[model samples]
Target chain A: MADRRYTKTHEWVTVDGKTVTVGITDYAQSQLGDVVFLELPSPGRTLGVRESFGVVESVKAASDLYSPVAGKVSAVNEKLSAKPELVNSDPYGDGWIMKLELTGELPPDLLDEAEYKKVTEAGAH
Target chain B: MVDFGGWELPQQYTSIRNEHLAVRKVAGLFDISHMGRLVVEGPGAEASLQWLMTNDLAPLAPGHAMYTLMCKEDGGAIDDLVVYRESKDRFLVVVNAANRAKDTAWMQEHLAGSATIEDHTKDMSLIAFQGPRAHELLPKGSSKTDDIPYFGFRAGKVAGESALISRTGYTGEDGFELFVDSGGVGEVWDAILAAGKAQGVLPAGLGARDATRLEAALRLYGNDMDETVNPYEAGLGWTVKLGKPDFIGRDALAKVKAEGARRSLVGMRTEPGSIPRHGAAVSHDGHHVGTVTSGTHSFFLGHPIALAMVEGPSFRVGERVTIEVRGREAPADVVKLPFYRGSARSAVAPAKP
Candidate 1:
């Protein structure tokens, strides 16, 4: 959890050596209630930092899923295609959207946990 | 929370999917106080309403309610509403929240008789208790609810508070809509939840309400029809009684009916993960034909459904169409209105125009 970094757009990222995993934060999922379907990028697709990779559709509206770090998609959570509600039930565990083979240094704007808490608090109002 | 028609209301209390399934399988309670309620009464109430509404009010006796539409002179719908005949000289007209001010002003400007209208929205609260098990789960000892037929209402007491209990709902389910004093509504809300908890009744919100109503093929005023869309085109021609002597839009509506509506509303279904949205383009054979008015992933039906208003000839059932979803055209099947039938008991079913 401490290694996890967040973006202002509410995506979270964590690095294990050069593999960076990404997913939407709990706050983001809470705001977009009852996710019904997600259009996820396929493995082997390249993405740039802060670039939209796919869409997340909820009952209320559709939202874009952005990449936190630049790299080629190594894997997509295929489970999400079948059980999109996982994004709401367990946002961090089974809901991790994709993993990237890191292509460059981590972005400088990623916020740490404590800093991300402030961002969520600011948005709560 | 979302700002809906100037009211801050929850889109869903917990989850839209859960609340929707609860209504289909058990029961769900909804706080619909934001809808506008008006009281019309006097010696000329019936005649005044008869001239204002498109539906024939003479057939709707006391204790019954009828769905009607108010249209502009050009036949475009101003709002769709329900008129409840409380008695010979009293009526309750429930209008959409967004169109409340406009509807009130229109009625006041066109009021031609001794009938008087009063805005009772702020003075009372409206709640919908709906589902298959609603009658069994309704709070015990409520008077006069046993024999209230579909679309019929009775003045009764719920949770020790005097309320108007109506056997009506937007969802295609057997349910009751309660009109209670605002001061006492909280108690009534709590009592129903506490009594029905064991039966898995959840306090639903706007999201579930919209989804269930869409499945029922009930039109949402602002989304499905507006001042530019006429009743005949919105699959609501049934609400327009051409036989009625004279109404505001009767001439225009009759003309449209005789000439036939240029566009028609049709239901379509798509595969899972391809949710159609409002304003999405609908096409046939690569030719643009229509736009989606309402759509959602139906958990109960295990697929996505959409209502589209299309041009040219109406598509036959089983015909294929394409709807733009997230910038791409997806194949969908033209289905019948009301993707699914629920437990509602009604005299007339919504028909395809």
Candidate 2:
């Protein structure tokens, strides 16, 4: 597994070769409460860095899911259609939202584990 | 946590889904101190309130409570509240937290005769214990709660602390809402949780409270009705008493009742994953007809449900409607109010002619 990188918006990405896996951090899922539904882009759709790719609907509210890096959508977690709660239970594993075929160099602004910790800490209050 | 009516409150103690199910299957405790509490007392208390509230309070004897609406002269609802008749000279009016200040002023401005109103919300603590097993699991140290009929309240002792226990709740379940001194409420709260811990009584929060109330089809103030929405249009016509000789909005409400309200509140259901949200547009045959007021995913019902304020004639049960979800229109069905029924002793507010 590669080192996980994060965005200030609370999404996390892990890059391996040319494929990058994306999911929201544990803190993000906790703040969102239960995950009820998610609308994701179909395969082959290209996404721009920082662009909103889809929506995540919880019981309390709906939030937009932002792309952390520019890439072509390769796959989405089809299981979420039937079992969205996985996002709350295992956000980093089976709850992985989508895999992106890296289109350009990973965004320079993506924070490493240590820097993302500071961002989450500042938001916790 | 979220800011609700100037109060910093948690949306859920844990997960909203767990807490919501706890209230339906076992029991859930909620700290609802944010709701406003007012005491109206004087020789003219009854007469004064009867004229201000839309519901006829003549039949509400001491120890009983009734749900009512306070309206403007134009028939728009100012607020919806529960009036508890403590006695012929004293009454307790509980109003929504967000409208506390406005309601307090309205009551004072409309004061008639010798009645005086005092705001008691800041000094009292309110807690709600609700579910099928709530009655059996409550920590009633010295209070005789068994005889307290639905909507009835009495001064009593719970967990050795003096409190006013009312048999009422927003959730569609048998429950009690306890009014205790702010200083002593912690003891009572702890005692109930300790006594019911083994029985699955969870401390719920605003999220669970909102979900359960929506499932019960209880109209939420501001969301379902406001100063611009009249009682008849909000499906709360039953709370209005046109027969009353004179009241603030009696004449206007009577007109709406006779001429028929232009819009009506109705329940709609959608498939899983297509949850409708507040302010979403509702249409039939591609024509805009309404907007969603309150909506959520009913975990117990395994589907999404909503309340919409629709224009023109009311839709019949099973009629088809489409709601805008995520920028696209999704098909929905006009279903019955209260998508599901729980163990509530009686309907919160019955629809009567």
Candidate 3:
């Protein structure tokens, strides 16, 4: 299994060599209600850590999608544009938003699965 | 849950799609207590309301209600409301929840004659049971639910609690809106849910309500029209009675009628799965013409529908327009106001087809 790290903003990133797969967490998808549309960044673009790279639109509202680490967009998820509900059904698998070529080492602030759970629980109320 | 005008309410109980389909195919119940309800009464209540609203309430007899608008002096809408002629001396006005204080103050500022307005929103609990099966699912209350005429209301006991049951709804479905005292709504709600379970009725939330209303082409106050939008521009010209005596925006609306509305709300449908959202730009032949006022994916229709405020009356039904969706211009065809018609419209008779 890939070791995944999470962000307070609900994005999850998994590193495999120099490439990383990024997607929103299940908790994030649930909170967004129904995912209707997504505007993802195109390949070849570079993003800084914590920078907004795209948008996720639910019927309730549109929220910004942020980058967890500095990286160059390697590939975009074309599947999401046609089936946005995949984010709700399978946020981790086929719902994976993008892949990136890491520009540097992993950020120090990324939370492991257990730490992310604690963060979500603390804010659940 | 989302904070809607300071009220924390769930966007959906289960899924937006499931809740929406439940309302269209079977039955659905909604807690609409967040809407503002006000009562205006006194010796000159009718006359005062006549001057306050765009609709000619002079012909509104007791037990009936009329959808109307309160406009500013500039002909822009203050709020769209339903005025209930409860009695010869009393009228009930229901406004949008977010516009409660603003609408109250506007009405009070125009206060005149022997009329007095009272806000009962905080003390009332309102529930809507809608769909083809709504009549069968909801408690009959104290009156025959079938006998109540469209836009008519009756005062009675429902689930052993005194309620005001009205034959009206926002879902474009034949249904009733039950108004009961806040303290006793629990019993009424329980009764309706228990009675509805057999019909596959679901306790719907705001998301389903939005889908149903939009499918009906019912204009939402803040989303489709606001203080800057006049009734005519919002496709609600029929509600304005120019023949009535001088009202708040009569002069301005009369002028607007002659000059014509600069923008008009039109309904449009895109191919299935392509949802247009509010603030999305609408273009005609490569020229930016309007913006999507309200848009949603209709789970029942299996496609996305939208109401856009396009420029002028030049845009005709069947006219093709393009809406910007997720940075791409997508095709949309202009259609008539309502995308779908349900039991409420056909309940009285059979279809010829």
Compared with the true structure, all predictions reach lDDT values of 0.91, 0.92, 0.89
DockQ for each candidate?
A: 0.87, 0.69, 0.33
lDDT of 1 by residue, B1-353 (tens): 88889988999999999999999989999999989999988988888888899999998899999999999999999999999999999999999999999999998877767889999999989999999888878786567565888899999998789999998999899889999999999999999999999989999999999899999999999888899999999999999998986989999999999999999999999999899998999999999999999999898998999999999556999999999998899999999889878888842344549
Comparing 1 and 3 on TM-score, the stronger one? 1
Docking class of 2: medium
Output candidate 3 Cα RMSD.
3.8
Worst 10 residues of 1 chain B by lDDT: B343-352
In angstroms, give how far residue B110 of model 3 lies from its true place: 2.8
TM-score to native of every candidate shown: 0.96, 0.94, 0.86
> Which residue pairs clash within candidate 1?
none
Clashing pairs in 2: none
Model 2 alpha-carbon miss at residue B261, Å = 0.7
Higher-scoring candidate on TM-score, 1 or 2: 1
Calculate candidate 2's fnat: 0.61
Report the C-alpha lDDT of model 3 over B88-174, residue by residue, as the tens digit: 989999989899999999898787788999999989889988888877666645455666777888887777789898988999988
